[model samples]
Target: MYLKSIALVGFKSFGRKTELAFGSPIVAVVGPNGSGKSNVAEAFRFVLGEQSMKSMRSKRGEDLIWGGSPGLPRANRGAVRVVFDNADRLLDLDFKEVVIERVVYRDGQNEYLLNGTVVRLKDVIRLLAGANIGGSGYQIISQGEADRILNASPKERREMVEDALGLKLYQHKKAESERKLGETGVNIDKTKSLRRELAPHINFLRVQVEKIEKARELKEQLAAKLNEYLAREHAWISQEDARLSEEIRMHETELRKLSESVRAARGARGSSSDAALAGLQGKLAEREGKLAAARRESERLARELGRAEGALEANNVTVEAIVPVPHVRNFARELDATVSELERVDDIARVRSVLQDIRSRIKSFIEGLSGAAPVTNEEVKQQVKSLADSLARVREEETNLADELESLRKGIAEARESGFAAERDLVALEASVREAQSKLGGVRAARENIAEARRRFEEEVREGIALVGAAVHSWEKAEIPPGALSEERSVQEKRRRDIERLKIKIEESGSGSGEAVVKEFTQTKERDEFLAKELADLEASAASLKDIIAELEKTIDARFHEGLKLINEALKNFFTKLFGGGYVDIRFVASQEDTRIGGSLGRGARAYLYRTHFFDDAGESSALPRSRRDRRRAR
Candidate 1:
């Protein structure tokens, strides 16, 4: 695989997003020195999982991003992406094109991604390994390391050459296999050690587990018995609940009908009483008005009667004070005798003569009374005259008073009748009110009794149906109310106590103390068994890895010898072409010693080769022969 395109954004020199597309092979990027041309190569290294900050020409994440120019804004982050053409499937991905990206923030945080999916740096490195690309491979020969392979140590040169020769992928595989093989060996040892440690515990748990199994069997039997009773009780309660609910409903319905009747009766009585009361009150008010009129009349009659009596007394005194004609008392008899004598004289002449004679006598009497010392003073005379007139008026008033007294008597009798009628009607209305109150009291008493019964029944239903179980304890809803159960509660209580006691006994015993102990025992046994199988699998894998390593070593040795032969021939011809009469030869070292420090292993030497040349002039001192002391560490 090869780089097809590159994209940079907010990088050290590429503040604005920039992209480069390479459609042809052997694309070269040339620019003046210090013109950020090297950044492009570093960008590739960054995208391909280079972790060395110094190598990217940055000491920190923020330094890798643009620090702002004269008129440009600073970037908060830097990103670089490189795309590869993977149509040949040379890279280990299922895509025609693979894009790898890296981003660094000013806060020293960084991330890697593959085709927009976030990934770790190790994933990117592992993916690129199969493509024979590495951070220090020959695919990217930076100017500073133009001859890096030539100067690299034996091990370092081995890595570089392997990439150039397309063997880096195999080496990576070998490394992974070796790492797995080593881990397998460690796991095998741990399994053996763990099994040894758990043996005593497993034996102890076995004894306890046997006891727990027996307890569990007893528990199962108890649960079965309990469930059977609960089921029966549940069914019985359900049936009885329906019946009780129906009965209660009927009772409530009857009570409601009775209550409605009572209310209706009350309404009727209230209307009747109200109407009666209004009529009685009106009659009472009317009678009171009539009584008030009667009282006023009585007072007026008494005042008139009193004034008449006073005037009559004064008249009597006046009559006495006046000198009455001396024959006034005898004159009334004389007049009566003359009127009788005139009646005896039937002749018209004789009758007229008799009336004249009577008139003459009355005149004689008045003249005699006036001449006799009667009213000799004019004042006395006027008084006597006034007394007479007053006496006449008094008589007239007395006549009028008698007639008025008769009418007042009639009015009093009518008012008495009206009062009696009102009183009788009031007494009847009061009787009705009392009767209605009595009926209302009885209805209220009945309603209270029924309401109390309903309350008691509701409480009984709530208590009778409540069921407590092992897993759940809450009020269970029934569509309708239920009646009390027939089964004695004592039997259920006894069974419950038995269940509780059994549970307590299990807790006291060492076997099934708690759920956690059972879980631990089961998990521990499973883990021990799993470890045994894992140990067998790991041993098998370790053996297979050893065979693979041996095969790889043999293949590498034979190939290395053949590669040396071919390179020696090519160098001989290349020296002849460059300078006449020159010979060159390359040969592999026989063996290498692994370095050690204080009995601990260090770096191992990898088989490599050196080239020799003879030009007859004998110059350049054998091209500075390479050795372990002079070689630097590999990239």
Candidate 2:
């Protein structure tokens, strides 16, 4: 590769765009001082990816931009581009010509471009290193820095010689490999530390997962036991329920039949007799009331008749006019008939009307007596006769009422006797009914006990389902063992106890978090495995980097020593030719102190060159030769 052209824009004194074309192998810029000759050389460094501002004769990036003159404006940025003729492909690019550019802004930001495409400073450095070119190398010697190689320390001079010999690429690769190896070592330590930290948690999760798995097993056992227990219990309860229902139905039917028998017995006995006797007793009471009223009327009529007789006997004076005897007899007969009708009339209204008619007739007869002329003795006799006949008729009615009352008393006595017998039979029938009701109540109470048992059984089923999940419903298809009904309840109780024990164990094991614990365990274990794999990969990469670093170091050392020998041979010839018959020699001397390489302690040596010149048997004097003591004293 060779220099083609360089372009500068807003760079230092080149405020406007500037281009320099180098068509020959050697080119020189002859300018007076302060005419940008140094700036042009610095632009080459800038475009080649120099990082230090002080090396470019500037304090900061903005100082590298052109400061305005009186007639020109200041630049906001500085850019430099170098084009290389790469027809020989020495630059590691496919193109015949390669352009590399760098731009620095006033804010101290920098941009790099390769062939018009943006790139990083590291990319530019790497690409340039392949062609044995670098920003700070012996290839671009400044005007006053011609003797820098002779004045530089052994290490710095070694680096400059290495750059000139085109070993900078190997040096860069070795340095990068060492840096990556250090980072890989740090990453390995971190990965191991992480694994150490994760160890206890992973173990804890393993224990939890084991516990959950055991709980799952116990739950499975509990579920199976529940299926059998629930199914058997349900079967027994159903059987009991049906049996109790049938017994209840039988008891109810018996109770109903007993009740009907009691009713039939009551009907077959003196149920109507009791009603007839009650009616006859009521009529007897009415007849007794009528007898008392008739006796009173009879007494009243006897008094009235005696009063009429006494009036006739005392007066002895006859009325001139007399009522006809037949009429008087007819009145007496009518009064008697009214009293009889009163006795026959059951209604009070009819009896009252009859009594009122008798009173009106008596009143009219007395009024006629007062109005009669003296017919006298005959009319008094007839009135006396009529009053006596009325008394007699009333007395007859009282006697008839007494006779009817006696018959009603006899009928009532017979009805009472019959009612006693019927009541005894009713009491016996009621006792039987009561006995049947007592039996029915006992059966109903037993049925209630069965119902309560069924309720309790259902409650147990619900509890089982809650504990073991809805899978308990699978119990419906479970078979009850033959003759399980004959098994003692204690057997079921034992089964229940077993179920409860399993449930307690399952709860203690925390089955509820089984799935989550398993998932977390799996994930944690996977993370640990992945980390382990990554750690192994990092260690392998670190090992590979170390190997590469060791190889590169070997190559660099070999090449450096070879280049030093060539340079010494050329220097010897040049010294002989330039000074005519004086001899100069350059050779390597190893340093003593240990050096750190790739974050490790190791032996390190740099070639320290000293020049010795001799003239005709005089001992040689060393130029720039220092022992360890002198070197230390210089430090």
Candidate 3:
């Protein structure tokens, strides 16, 4: 797949959203210095999951975003997106086109999206790898990058060539395999250590297993005895169940007979009592009516006799003439006339209530004199008080006038009462009402007595009826209800006990005796013994296998170095041709594993040469080329 277009927003010098389109094979991005030419390369790196901020020439994530310049305001985010045309199925995707976008926020958080769906950076790397456009490969080249191939150390140069030749994937696989192999080695060591620790125990288990076998035989004998005992217990339980059922039947028969007898007794009592109470209530009511009539007759005769006696006593008494109480005007009328004529004195001051205020002020003036200053007597405060009291009194006078007007209205009504016949009729009617009141009081007393008697009669009847009904109901309930069959409780108890005993026997067979311990020992010992045999067989098999793997890895590693050397040679030649004239060569650095500490092994050698031409100038004296010891000797 080839890149089709790229978009940059707030990334480096591309402050605004910028889009660049590319054609089939190659697209050259050319611009003057600081015109965002390199920014295009950085954009590619950014979208392709390059995470090295240092390599991108940025100190912090925020540096990638646009900060406000003189003409432009700062943007909150930086983003780079690259679109690819995958019509040739160069990438591991079914789509004809793919878009990869990355955005960096000022807050140091980042996001990546693949085809508008958010994904991880690793996904982008893997996708590029599938397209044969991996990191540090020949697909992308910079100005210095082309020359670096020949200048790089043999190991680094080899890695570069391997990347181009598609060996990088294999190397990655090998590294991953080595990592897993290391972990497996650790696990194997731990397993071996465990086996060593268990060796003594394994021997002990073997002895235990032998004892277990014998114990198991003994357990079989015990289980047989237990089975025989259970059979005997079962027979005993069956016989006892029959006996218990027979006894339960007898008790149930007795209980049933007793219940019937109790029911009959209760029914007889209820019938006899209700009849007697009914008859007695009718007789009592009749007697009560007769007594009430007798009492009434007695009261009537007594009232008549009292009237007769009063007349006789009146006739016997001599009456002196009490001169007709001369139409004495009642004191009420006298009081009214006196109040009306007693003082036609102008009550303006009294009505004004100012007289009370004047008296109050005179009293205060005297009191203030006792504490007065000679120059300005404290009477000023007292005078203020007097004025306030006068104002209040004047208000009171107005209130009193209003009250007098109301009193005048009442007096007018009273004066009119003297000629009101309806009022006189009402008073006469009231006197008759007093007489009726006395009769009503007597009638109320009679009603109260009747009510109390009726209450007592109802209470007695209700209680008697309830008591009799409760007794009857209780007796019926106590009678034996049908379908209630007693259980053979003893038989059930025996069966439960047998079950419990059988369970206990099973547990005893499993754990209580040496048989169980022996069985455990046998199983454990057998397992370990088998493991030991298997381990021996595995060790033997692995011995040859380990040697083969070691030899194979060594061969592969050697061949890898060889192929790497060949590629470096080719890369150097390609670079020399591409540059036209550049004396460039790669040097090899041996691994630490091949180097001796005392420098027994010589310094690494150079193999690849990228030389367009080599010319020696006679006029220029060549620097002395000698070993360090020879140079020191000459000095």
Candidate 4:
């Protein structure tokens, strides 16, 4: 690959766009001193990723850009491009012509481009390294720099030789590898320290994890026991509810029977009451018939008494004997009490018997309290006897009527009493029913409350079980708490308490270091493994660097020795021709001087000395610019 062309724009002295093509293998750039010829070389350096401003004849990025000559417009930035002819593809480029560019901004920023695509400075460096080209190497030599190698310090000289021998790439690789190795060592130390810090925490987490596992196991067992207890409790509650319902149904049935009986009694009374009352009234009318004949006898006696009033005044005649009632206050009170009791007693037989007793007492009382009277007039006695006989006849005919009327009265009274009793019983039965229903309602509310509480408890238990069981495949069939057969409420309560306690234990055991701890451990281990792998890779890179550096050393040695040998032969021929048969010799100033690495190890500058033998009839040594200053200038 050879440089084909170079383009410059706003670069140093080249303010406008400029292109220079180099088609021939050899091209000479000739110009007077200070005519911007050196700027071309600086441009090459700039494009090749040179960072040393002094070497580029500039102190800052702005110095590389055009700063407006007297008659030219000021430019803001600068760019330089070099094109390569890569017909053989030696530069590993697909294009026949490859372009590399570098741009400097007014600011300190700079950019590199390959074939118009923005790239990095290192990309340019690496590409040049492939072709044994460098920004300050043998590729671009100047007349003034011809003796640069001889003027260089021993260490710099050695570096020049290495660059010339195309070992710069290897050196760069070795340096980078060493840098990475150093960084890797630091990282390894940091990783070890991190592991040291985490070790105790991890161990603590391990203990916590063990406790958490135990807690989880306990929770699973508690949940299983709770499920069993809850199911049993539900069954018992259901049975109790059914029993209460059945009892309520029985009470309701009895209430219905009582209600029907009361209704029947009322209906019977309602149907027969008016008819019985009317029949008693007719019997009473018939029983009162003797009073009419007694009334006529009384009227006739009244007239006779009226006529005999005058005669009776002269003769105080005796009347028939009559009894008087007793005047005792207790008798009146007793009579009132009997009458009240009789009012209450709706039974016809009872009323009649009580009335007869009361009448006999009243009559006896009157007789005891008052004296008897006798009939005074003879006509009045005859009239009384006749009326009494008539009354007796009438009473005998209606005696059966009295019995019938009494029977009817008794039936009506019994019916009335039965009706009253039935009403009382109905009222009492309604009250009892209301009381029973109120009690039943309370029982139902309590039962429902219990049911709701049970449902919520069981749901919470199942939810807890599900949470624990999600982590355990065989959790459903796990063993539960002991002895929970018949006592459902106690069993469920125990399970609930156990669940709460287990949860507390779980919290106390450090829930933090459970699944997360496992994940962290796994991730940390992976990170450690990755670090180890990275360390190994860094070590391998260091080893490869060592091999490459050794190889570069060997290459420099072989190439330097071989090149010096060929140069010495060419020098001998040049000396013979320049001075015509002069015997000349060229050798290192010291044995170490011949070797760049070995010579640079010494204190003095690495150099070469020459001796000449002038042959003029007799073989003799002749001087040729023997001063050190002249020799250095020639070099």
Candidate 5:
């Protein structure tokens, strides 16, 4: 590969755009002193990634720019571009032409471009190193630098010789490898530190995860126990409730039947006794009324008879003496008629009239008797006898009525007694009904108890479901031990207690936020693993770089020695032709003291040349004495 063209703008003496194209293998630029010929060479160095201002004959970036001269304004920036011909693929680029550009601003900032794309100085250097080209290499020789190889120190000469032999590429690779190794070591250290920082937190999260797992296990166990206990309790309560319901239904039915029987019995007793008593009481009342009437009639008749007897005793006259017999008989008959009419009359007025008629008749009879007739005492006696008989008959009628009333009262009393007996039987039946009702009440109360127990069981089931999730609904499918229902309530209660204890333990464990903790732990663990992997990779890369550096070192040393030998042979032939005499030898010598190179201390290779029998071979040919200047240069 060879430089095909160079373009410069505002670079030192080139204030305007300029381009130089080298089409042939040899090209020369001739100029007088004070012209800008050397500027072209420096421009090449500037474009090829030169970093030292002193090498470019400048103190800073701005010095590389044109300081305006004679009607020309100063340039603000300087730029140089070098194009390479890559037809032989000597440079690691795909194009037939490679252009490298560098620009310097007055602010001491520099920019690099590769193929017109912005890049870094390191990129340009690396790319150039691949083509065995560098800013400070033997590719460019200045006027005074023609003898610089002879005057340069052995170490400098060795570097120049290495550059000529294309060993600079290996040097660049070695340097780059060393730099990468150092950076990789730093990354490894950082990775280790990160892992160390993550350790404690990961451990803490692990503990929390373990606690969450334990709580989960306890919850599972609690759920199982709850299922068994609740299922059995529900079954038992259901059975008891059903049994109590049946008992209540039976007792209710029995009580209803008994009540009906008591009602029927009461109805029968009431119907019979009430009808009998009512009939007998009515007959007795009727008979008593009849007896009272008879008595009253008898008393009236006795009164009438006494009055008649009094009237007869007062009169004390024999009817025969007082009047004619027929007349007296007629008077007596009239008097008797008057007395019967008075007794039969219910109106006072008619009775009074009848009595007045009798009085008037008696008076008339007396008058008539005064004239002629007399009455018999037998008529009076007859009338009195009739009234007495009437009284006696009424008395007998009252006696018969009293007897009938007494009989009727006896029947009524018997009816009342029968009613009482019926009442007693009704009371007994009602008592039996009450007893049945009492039994039903007890059964109902038992049913209420069972219902309450069922309610409590349902509540427990809900609580279990809340605590242990929907697993509580699975109680129907739970495996129960044989005869579990036959066990005492205490056993079920114990199981319930176990469940409660486990629930409390689970509550105390945590709020189940361990999922988040576990997630975080997983992420942290993954990060740690990734970092560990990265550290391993970095370590591997550093090891590989070291191996590459070692290999490059070996190759560089071997190739450098080989090139040095070839250069020495060329030097011998050239020396003979140039000086027309003597012999020259070039060889490598190791320095006794360590030298600092590329930021590392190492033994340095110094090139030494010995010339004999030309002009200074005054004594026997011996190895050229080491000059103090050369030793100083080596140091």
Candidate 6:
């Protein structure tokens, strides 16, 4: 059988239903990472009964389920089902096709089904094994498993090749045969033990047969007594059951009447309930109206208070901005001094220029005296005098300029301080006005909030009033009241209790005073029946076991004879190949039990060897190795 198709539902990453079909001889699966292609291979393994979760790349069985992604909801369980085409009669039974399914739940539980009927994992494994198919079998080789044959030891490799040769059927049969042989041995031992145990009982029964015959008569007498007693008790129970049944009937009738009365009473009280509900509605409306009026009054008072505060804050700003006259006068004097100082600093530059010009003319006159010569004393002295006068005047002028520049700087510094203070006072006045305006805006907002709250309350009060009036009108039409229902329910409960008491009386009367005796008798009868059934089953098992033992003995004898026949034929072929001869030898040994005069069961072939000679190129006569006695003596 070959796999035809597999269907997956919520198994691994195949979140939705998916199906894969296989071609006759080859089916290739190719995919990128996480496309669930490997999961498809694993699905085959799962349905084939692979019990190792680790081999499947999962730490727990529930890991096989598809935990949904962000776009799809999670599934609670997973399923993988495989279909097989069995038309070639590869499987043990003849069927066109087979479908097997395996399901796993998040709770780490698994279920297996065959053709929609639940079955065990053992059944699935056996079915696949019959077809020479399994998780790691030759028919399905995964990419990584190719090296398994290379890595296997000699014995394991032999086993693998044997399985590929379709020897699994023979191996399974051999194992099953061995298991049956072992079980039969165990059963033989058990049966022998049972026979030993029954020996004393069998002997005892043989001795007690005569007494048992006498006891049978007494048993019949006891049975008659039991029947007589049971009949008397049955009559008393029947009479009691009848009386209780009649009382139960009377109670049932009364209960029905009381139930009808309750329905009528509840209908009559409907009008009163409606009226009471209407009054409550009216009261609720009145409270709502008072609440609305209070809110409106509070809002009006809030608005008036806000207006008054705004007017007061606005007037306060004007009074704070009035300045003192002395401050203004100080500012005017500082500005005047600054302008005068600016004029004095402008004249010192001209004086310094006249001094520099006088000095330069003196130096030019001295240098013009003569080409190679040192100056005469009188000329040198005259030049020195002119220079001294120019230098002395420049120094005096610079001293005067320095004193004037110092005074000007002092005046400018004082003016700057006064200007900064004036700027500060202006800024403070502007800030106070802004602060007052902010407070006025906030007060107005608060008043508006209160007015809105009052309006909402008024609307609710009007709606509540209308709701109460409508409810009152509805109540008048309803025709229902409350208390009558409670009274009628009490009467109904009494009738029900009466019915229950009558049922108890009927049941007790049937059971009667002889209940203890009857219970004991029934228990005894059940015990006897169980003992008899067990005895019958044990006798059947013992008989079947004898038949099985005889059959096994005959089969083993026949198989041993057949094995010797095959061994002889194989020996004949092997010898002819080794010896290059026309004649061959074959033999069968007598069974060990038949050779009771046992010397050491000697080592030699049972078949006597004989040789036939053939001619060489010249046709000469030749002698051949033959005769056990001649060969042994020569060695």
User: Whose lDDT is greatest here?
Assistant: 2
- Best first by TM-score, ranked: 2, 5, 4, 1, 3, 6
The deviation in Å at residue 80 for candidate 1 is 1.8
lDDT of 2 by residue, 121-140 (tens): 87888788998896555777
Per-candidate TM-score against the hidden true structure: 0.47, 0.64, 0.38, 0.54, 0.63, 0.33
lDDT string for model 1 (1-635, tens) is 67789999998899999999998977878889887899988888778877888888788878889889988899999999888999999888999999999999999899998989999876787788777686664666777685665555555655555565555555555666677777888888988999889888887777778777767665565555445444444555555556555655665565555556656655655565556555655544444443333344334434433543454355453333444533344555565565556434424455455545655665565465445543223333443343344334334434444555555555555555544554455455555555555555555555555456456444433422322224121223222234335667676557556755655655565453346666777888998898888878888898998777656556655655566566668878888788775576644454455521111122242544443435444543244245554334211
Question: What does each candidate score in C-alpha RMSD?
Answer: 26.7, 16.1, 44.4, 15.3, 12.1, 54.0
Off by over 4 Å in 5: 10-15, 30-35, 58-78, 103-111, 116-123, 142-155, 220-495, 596-635
TM-score preference between candidates 2 and 3, better one: 2
Clashing pairs in 6: 269-480, 269-481, 270-479, 270-480, 270-481, 271-479, 271-480
lDDT per residue for candidate 6 within 113-220, as digits (tens), equals: 987889987677667766766444555566777776545433344345445544444444444444554565566566556656655655554444433433333333
Question: Where is model 6 more than 4 Å wrong at Cα?
Answer: 169-635
For all candidates, the clash counts are 1, 10, 1, 16, 8, 7
**How does candidate 1 fare on TM-score?**
0.47
- The order of the candidates by lDDT, greatest first, is 2, 5, 4, 1, 3, 6
Whole-model lDDT values for every prediction: 0.61, 0.79, 0.53, 0.63, 0.76, 0.50
Q: What's model 2's TM-score?
A: 0.64
Clashes in model 3: which pairs? 212-518
Displacement of residue 287 (Cα, Å) in model 6 is 99
- The better candidate by TM-score, 2 or 5, is 2
TM-score of 5: 0.63
Which consecutive 10 residues in model 2 have the weakest lDDT in total?
Answer: 594-603
Q: Who wins the TM-score comparison?
A: 2
Identify the runs in model 3 with alpha carbons over 4 angstroms from their true place. 9-16, 24-35, 59-79, 102-123, 130-132, 137-150, 183-227, 230-635
Q: Higher-TM-score candidate among 1 and 2?
A: 2
